[model samples]
Target: YMLARSTGARIIVEFGTSSGISTLYLAAALRDNGGGRLITTEFEPSKVMRAKANLAEGGLIDLVEVREGDALETLSADLPERIDLLLLDGAKALYPEILSLVESRLRPGALVIADNADFSPEYLERVRSLAGGYMSTPFGDDVELSMRLG
Candidate 1:
């Protein structure tokens, strides 16, 4: 979250909103950054409700929009013109596809963080590819952090 904030992120798109744990963290950063939008997706209806409630309790619901559906569908349309930050923590199998959907909108120098990236070798490979338009490396244990270079 601080990484996103320190980089001056104002438009963040997250692929998972499970229980709103990470949502709250990102939203707090946005709030402290003087406000921004955090668009997050969750496939389960129950989780969506829980996440919404959690965000409301954190007083950050206004800063977030929870899209309830498969991320491939929910995140495929109506994205911001330029995304400053993207967090991928959804169905591991769809990481590459989801990245494709958002890749064109990523601003130069934008950050893409994929959690549990070990489960998506295709995603890791794409980001690490020499022609992938990104500079990427494994972050910590399970995360893959990539930055848009163009």
Candidate 2:
């Protein structure tokens, strides 16, 4: 996250922020970089509130917007065509659907960092197929999957 933020990427979207545990990490990274935004989605309203509270406790409320609703549906309608980083942490069953949505919206140089990817067969295959320049990192592998549109 530090490395990615160092690139000065401005927009980030995250799915499945169940409790904002991961959200904190992303928010901290973005805050460290001086300026950035993290739009995150959670299906459960309660989880959304909890996440918001958690982020607030972590002093990251201003940097993260916790959207409450079906992540896929919300993203399909609202996600911008230009996203710098996308973190997939939603439902395992809906992984494919979200993947397609992300691919359709991702900018050419945008990066997709998936968590629990090892759990999804389709995800592994898709990542393996799409990643052109791959780098093994401490958390997982970073791959240059596509190029952002100008």
Candidate 3:
């Protein structure tokens, strides 16, 4: 969250909103940064409701839009023109497809954080490849952090 704020990130897209734990972090950053938008998706209706409630409780619901549906469908349209940060922590198998959907909108130097990336070897391979258009490396233990270069 601090990293996103430090980089002046105004548009954040998160693939999973499980109870809004991560959403609160991002929303707090947006609040501290004055204002911003967080578009988060969750396919499970129950989780969506819980996340929304959590966001509301955190007083950050105004900064976030919790979309309910498979992210591939929910996040396919109405995205920000320039996405600053992307968090990929949903269905691990769909990380590549999610990235594909948002790749064109990622500004140069955009940051992508994929948690539990080891579950998706293809995603890891794509991001680590020189031809992938991103400079990527493992972060901490299970996270793969990539920066879009193009």
In order, what lDDT does every prediction score?
A: 0.93, 0.72, 0.94
Please provide TM-scores, in order, for all candidate models, with all chains considered together: 0.98, 0.79, 0.98
Badly placed stretches (over 4 Å) of model 1 are none
Clashing pairs in 3: none
10 residues in a row with least lDDT, candidate 2 = 129-138
lDDT of 1 at 33: 87
Candidate 1's TM-score: 0.98
Q: Please provide, for model 3 over 20-92, each residue's C-alpha lDDT reduced to its tens digit, 9 standing for 90 to 100.
A: 9999999899888889999999999999999999999989999999999989999999999999999998999
| Residue 73 alpha-carbon offset, candidate 3, angstroms | 0.4
In candidate 1, where is summed lDDT lowest over 10 consecutive residues? 1-10
When sorted by lDDT, best at the front, the candidate numbers are: 3, 1, 2
Clashes of each: 0, 7, 0
* CA error at residue 123 for candidate 3, angstroms: 0.6
RMSD of model 2 against the true structure: 3.7
lDDT of 2: 0.72
